[model samples]
Target: MSAANRSGADNQPGVLVTGASGFVGRYLLRRLQTEPVTVSTLQRPRHDLLQPASLTELCQGVDTVYHLAAYAHVNQAQIKTLYATNVDGTINLLSAAVAAGVRRLVYVSSILADPAFDQPRTAYGEAKQRAESLLQAAHQAGDIEVVIVRPVNVYGVGMKGNLMTLLRLLRKGVMPPLPRFTQPFSLIGVEDLCQALVLAAQCSVGDNAPIYALTDGEHYDIKSLEQAMRTALGRSQPAWATPKAVFYLGALTLEIAGRLLPINNSPGLRSYHALARNYAVDDTASQRDLGYNPRSTFYCTLPAIISAMDAGSAGADTSDTDNTQ
Candidate 1:
């Protein structure tokens, strides 16, 4: 928790970060330190979104708010908790921000929020979508200026989620080789995402409150991505590719096991869909509007991710890890 200058000849703009302890939030905090703005972090139980009174106190004197905290678990079992935290929590936080006179809110939304995605919506995605609508409504009503950023699959050092699962399996040498899937998948490095977030905070928006999709501007297929990870991990490429049926069967077993036991975030059809589908994004608006130029590609960042995983930092309680389901 950092303090803002209450009174100064030139009042440095006050910035508050909601998910200060999450994956992207951690990188964002580091990025903000280099900027001129004074930064403040949410104090957990004291500043929880569900607790509106705490949020109101936290937002006082804050000019910009980065709303990153949310229940990101993709498991269906957590649907009730997801809505309570992601949707209702967002509503509570938005009200507090408005009441406290916060000038702008830069929301780190997910690409899943776009209804255009072909895959079935996860509980996590629906929650994010609902929260985005509330923020848009607030912006339209002139309560606060809003900039919504829908980031593609974010990857970097210490990243969790699907990629982390893949890495761990690959490290153990028990994972089968991936099939040749040509569908493109878009990914943005965490550092690049943080840069785009800061840029979003500074850029002006229209009355409609523009939404930006961010990517690393690199095209990747399942095979290429897996090969790159294997290379980074110093593993030899498998001569044979595992059939899609085997992958699906394994996922189904995990799904059943998850239901029977206490497994959260079991690999099921959703994981298969994510792995096989073309979950790409267009960042032309982001480039034109916010001057967002992503510098790191998945191929380039694999070494760092491998390094972090080797050091046993992958499954930490960061943003991606917390919502890895």
Candidate 2:
């Protein structure tokens, strides 16, 4: 393992945040600035995961790295790009961190890394899973202290992808009847995730374990999810519960349309499969290992997310909001 202490303020930990300009990265950077730590961003001209040559310079003097850079695209067509960025890039960054004598790494992995979902795993999820395996191997070899976190349905200001799409449908009074499933969907706000990450970076490292954790706190089932969100958003339209056939038909139609048209707004098969998996993570270990108490629930954070959606939709073309996160 690299020689460095996590709890020293005199020689404070030099934290490096990859994907610093991204949605969650921006929140993390903001939170880091409030602490007595040295901060650096692995962004743009000087540093990039795609450009492996840039990694050494970014890793220099950095004691802890918050790796959030990954190709988050859900489209199967981007599989090659996803593997190149998510898997290979992590290998390159891990190598760089080891060479730089970094102590610990807090990797921003996804809950979808599991292959136990209702549908065949996505290329995006597969890529993230491969990346986690690589990081875990390095930890097992004593390269660094690894804290791998799998977050479920991360939502906050400036969020996009499936959650926002569902919210939009609800706002337009076209939200399909809530599904009858009783399985819960967990979520973590950007702010809450940032706090957990800080805790991960500060916690004492030992030969105890690799520190694998998930982020989740609420228990909003699909049926109650719609009701809670509608109430929170002050929607007057009462949502109905439809059969699985209705959703399947709608998803298939949209999938077919996406292939035919130039539209890229389709949610694809993975979105349908995701809602059926009882998608919530167990946060007990996270709460015990790191002082992670996620404060935002699905119902509470909707206002910020809606405002962000409005701001994003009003100013830019569709291409600007074309994120897969």
Which candidate tops TM-score?
Answer: 1
lDDT of 1 at 187: 82
Please count the clashing residue pairs in each candidate, in the order shown: 2, 1
TM-score of 2: 0.85
Poorest 10 consecutive residues by lDDT, candidate 2: 314-323
lDDT by residue for model 1 over 1-325, one digit each (tens)?
Answer: 3432222223688888888888888888889888888788887656677877777777888899998887775455666987898889889988988999999999988888876663656777777888889999999999999999988878888677777788889988988898777788788888999999999999988889889988888877878878887888889999999888888888778867866766666677666777777766789899889999989998887887787777877645544313332
Candidate lDDT (C-alpha), each: 0.80, 0.71
Among these predicted structures, which one has the highest lDDT? 1
Off by over 4 Å in 1: 1-10, 258-261, 313-315, 320-325
Cα deviation in Å at residue 293, candidate 2?
1.8
Overlapping backbone residue pairs in candidate 1 total 2
Candidate 2 lDDT, tens digit per residue, 1-325? 1222122254767888877667777778789888888787765655667777778877888888998877664344555777888889899999999999999999888776767632555666677788888888888789888888777666677776666666778878887665676766677777888898888887866653244445557766766766766766678645457888788777788777755665544565556666676666678978987867777776777776677666764122111111332
